[model samples]
Target: MISVVLLGSGNVGTHFFKAIEKAENVRVAQWFSRQIDSIKGYKNKTAITDNLSELMEADLYILAVSDDAIATLSSALPFENRLVVHTSGSVNVHDLDKKNKRGVLYPLQTFSKGAEMDFKNVPICIETLDKKSYPILKEVATSLGSPTKRVNSNQRRVLHLSAVFVNNFTNQLYRIGHEITESEAAEFDLLKPLIMETAKKIQTLSPYMAQTGPAKRHDKKTIEKHLDLLKNPEHKAIYKLLTKSIQNTHGR
Candidate 1:
């Protein structure tokens, strides 16, 4: 079995650790975290450690820490010239330096604790400075049910930024929708069908063609009504700007 150490227990780390538990030929040899109480459940089979020395024996160390702590934590690890990988999207693999056989194992999707994800469907973005380590990482990724893709550092950065807009921004829009409906005591569940349909359409329709609403048709009366309904200044500004943008794009 290929022994591995995971160095964080946050959202991504927790999801990844659980997913890896189901794969063969791999085992979580050790786990390290500052807050040991949070991960007490994993202390049974996996050696849990707050000290860096316990990480010495593992074949590979996966730093699931934040991008800001990568350099500091890497420098503190007891061993040198061992294989090390990080799971980060915005941070480049090169940031880990040449001290270890550095690589990246970025999952392109958002991870939330307690929410199950299909490892098979999530694309695994893999990168490595050492060519020999690439296949090993690929095999590990495949065994865990992910579709692997080789992405360079620059491409990974762009992909991550795009993910924020598509996932984060869209979720914020949903939250706004919920808030608006709740204020007037309307059921937010009413929007579920529309939400699912909008997402389904994107699979076949170009977003531009699938786009609808008063903004696309230049229904000035509806736009004015929406503006009047919006109580938050920021939300109103956003709605007005987006409407104007959509109108301009469609030549309305």
Candidate 2:
């Protein structure tokens, strides 16, 4: 059986715990959190503790904490020369304490507290200098129904930056769209289908080829009207910047 000790009580840790619970041949040996109350629910199911000295020896110790806390936490682990991994997209696999086998098990998706995600559909990115632990991580991903990929630190960094543009920046644009609709006393939900279709289109078509907008078409009048409609200076600036970027991309 593959034993995993999850160290963190945040959204990623919580989601991983649920995934590992239903996975076969894998069991959680213990959970570590500074605040025991955060993970008290799992007390009856598995060992939970705030003390690092009480940490159990496991095949893999997965640190699912914030990027900033990863290095410090891994360095403070009591044991050494064991398989230890972190679930971060941007953080380096080498960030883990060198005393242990370092690896990255980055799931390329946004996680929310109490949000249910289908792991089977999520992509898991793994990177490690020690290939010995690859099988264990691969098996865990397979059991959780996630697709696995080997991504080195440099590649993972680029992927994280792209994710920021595609996911984070896009989400901000959605919020802006909602604000605009709300200002006009319109239902933001009305744009849901359009948003969904925009996402779906990129799955089958190149974004450049799929591009269709006033900016892409070089419709200066329409773009001007959109900029004029925005009451917020920040929104107008963003609109102009995006419009100019699109025009330059398409040679409009």
lDDT of each: 0.87, 0.91
TM-score for each model: 0.94, 0.98
- Best TM-score goes to which candidate? 2
218 in model 1: Cα distance from truth in Å? 1.8
- What clash pairs does model 1 have? none
lDDT of 1: 0.87
Top lDDT prediction, candidate number = 2
Please, what are the lDDT tens digits per residue for candidate 1 over residues 1-252?
A: 777898998998888788889989678888899888878998886789888876647667889999998888887887778888999999878778567789999998888898998898789999988898888788878878999999999999999999998899999989988999988999999999999999999999988899899999889899999999999898898898889888888998
lDDT of 1 at 177: 87
lDDT of 2 by residue, 146-197 (tens): 9999888999999999999999999999999999999989999989999999
By summed lDDT, the worst window of 10 consecutive residues in model 1 runs over 52-61
Model 2, which residues run further than 4 Å from truth?
A: none
Model 1 RMSD, rounded to 1 decimal: 1.5
Q: Which TM-score value belongs to model 2?
A: 0.98
